[model samples]
Target: MFGILVSAFNVALGFVLRTVVVKFILFFGLYFVVQAFVPVLASLLPKSVDIAGLFSSLPDSVWFFVNMFMVTEGIKLMFSALLTRFIIRRIPLIG
Candidate 1:
């Protein structure tokens, strides 16, 4: 029984370390990096256009199609690909 308990604890610890801790560290690290670059990115966009109003003025039909597209796996896949690329580029030696 003690051996079984030890094994279970080991598995749980590994999962916590690998998934929980790593994701927490990665998320905040990436968030800070992106936040720092927001000003630089914003400078490249046009200042006159009201981006919020443009989206808000979209017709229901257009929004319906956009919602359908977002419900698909493509968005998640593309986002993950971008994140992977960003993470890869952040590495000192490999990048």
Candidate 2:
């Protein structure tokens, strides 16, 4: 009985390491790679553009329309992504 328990424990440990540890490592590896490139991508945006002034110069009517559209789309997109992630994580092995 002791030997059987040891063998089962070893198998379970192996499975956990293979799946959980490997996935954790891969996710962080990718995350770091993306993080390292963020500054480079950010540098590509125009630094000379006065974003605040540009927005302030827009007419109130147009600004309200644009603001409402952006807010609506952003909420919809964020909610959809969060819901999908929540559902995926609740699944057995797919998460």
Candidate 3:
């Protein structure tokens, strides 16, 4: 019983450390990258049109949602691939 409890606790702790913490760090890193580059990217667009007006037309919520979605999907893919590799390594002999 103690062994089982210890195993469960370890698994939960590992998940928090490996998945949650790592994902949070990666998400913030990606956000900073985007924030740093967005102005540069915007400047690259053709200046004949009113880019500022187009950007201002959208509500802050829309940009937040899009950014969240992109970061989440990217993290999901990265985590899935990492989990798959872990599982593969754990497989008996075949791994």
Candidate 4:
């Protein structure tokens, strides 16, 4: 299923989707930045809150999952930054 969609995109967009994909990646990084640290900045949370206990009962690797995904997001953000700079540097001079 995924491969079929990718083939369709490759045929239709002529790789012109790079900028859009990079922007999405950057947005994803922003999302992960919020998710991974929300527990730490949980002062606005209720007094009965317990982050560790809340998550501990679940699978033991939840933190690992978050870290792995966030690392990928960081890489994507880097690529997005690079692509944005590249695009910006191509603008025609006005002066």
Candidate 5:
């Protein structure tokens, strides 16, 4: 049935698309955490690292933002995979 096949194909494609979107959103979220929290963490440090001063080193741009977004996405996926496995192993789910 072409209609059934088309519906199934759309569902499958949606799943695939969501996977990619999740990667990008999660990556940006992770990077946002790092960007926001690192300074707070640095404040607690002994002050030699000067990370607080490093924001000036990076000029804000479309390129920087996008590259960091991609890198952050990879980091997010890595951690999310690890965390999901760890939690799934510990928790039981009911259908």
Candidate 6:
């Protein structure tokens, strides 16, 4: 019973650690890669556009909700890709 409990604890700890590490890598890796395009994206915007006015029109609550939703979706998509690859590799016929 003790051995079984130890094994189960090890497996859970391993999974938790793997998840944290993978999420950190995926989040920051994608963040830096996307940040590299900031200048190009900025240049594409028309200089005459009123950026401040555009943001000022929206309520703070709306902005907060949108940002939260976008962040949640992005993380979910990134993790899903990792999970899909894991699933694909586990298929006996695929290997």
List the candidates' TM-scores in order.
0.47, 0.54, 0.46, 0.29, 0.38, 0.41
Candidate 2, after superposition: displacement of residue 21 in Å? Answer: 1.6
TM-score of 5: 0.38
Output the lDDT of residue 87, model 3: 47
| Model 6 lDDT-worst window of ten | 86-95
- When 1 and 2 are scored with lDDT, the better candidate is 1
Ranking by TM-score: 2, 1, 3, 6, 5, 4
Clashes of each: 0, 0, 0, 0, 1, 0
Misplaced by over 4 Å in model 5 are 1-5, 48-95
Could you give me the TM-score of model 6 versus the true structure?
Answer: 0.41
**Leading candidate by lDDT:** 1
lDDT string, candidate 3, 2-88, tens digits: 999999999999999999999898767766765666567557757696645765787888979757778547766996788557544
In model 3, the runs with Cα more than 4 Å from the true position are 49-95
The worst-scoring run of ten residues by lDDT in candidate 3 lies at 86-95
Question: What lDDT does the true structure give each of the candidates?
Answer: 0.76, 0.75, 0.72, 0.64, 0.65, 0.71
* Deviation in Å, model 5, residue 27 alpha carbon: 1.8
Q: What are the C-alpha RMSDs, in order, of all predicted structures?
A: 9.4, 7.5, 15.6, 19.1, 15.2, 13.6
- Residue-by-residue lDDT tens digits, candidate 4, 2-92: 9999999887686557777777777677667656555564565468757557556766477688676785577669967875564445433
Candidate 4 TM-score over all chains jointly: 0.29
Model 1: how far is 94 from its true place, Å?
20
Off-target runs (Cα >4 Å) in candidate 1 are 46-95
* Candidate 5, run of 10 with poorest lDDT: 86-95
Instruction: Give the range where candidate 1 is weakest over 10 consecutive residues by summed lDDT.
Output: 86-95
User: Whose TM-score is higher: candidate 3's or candidate 4's?
Assistant: 3
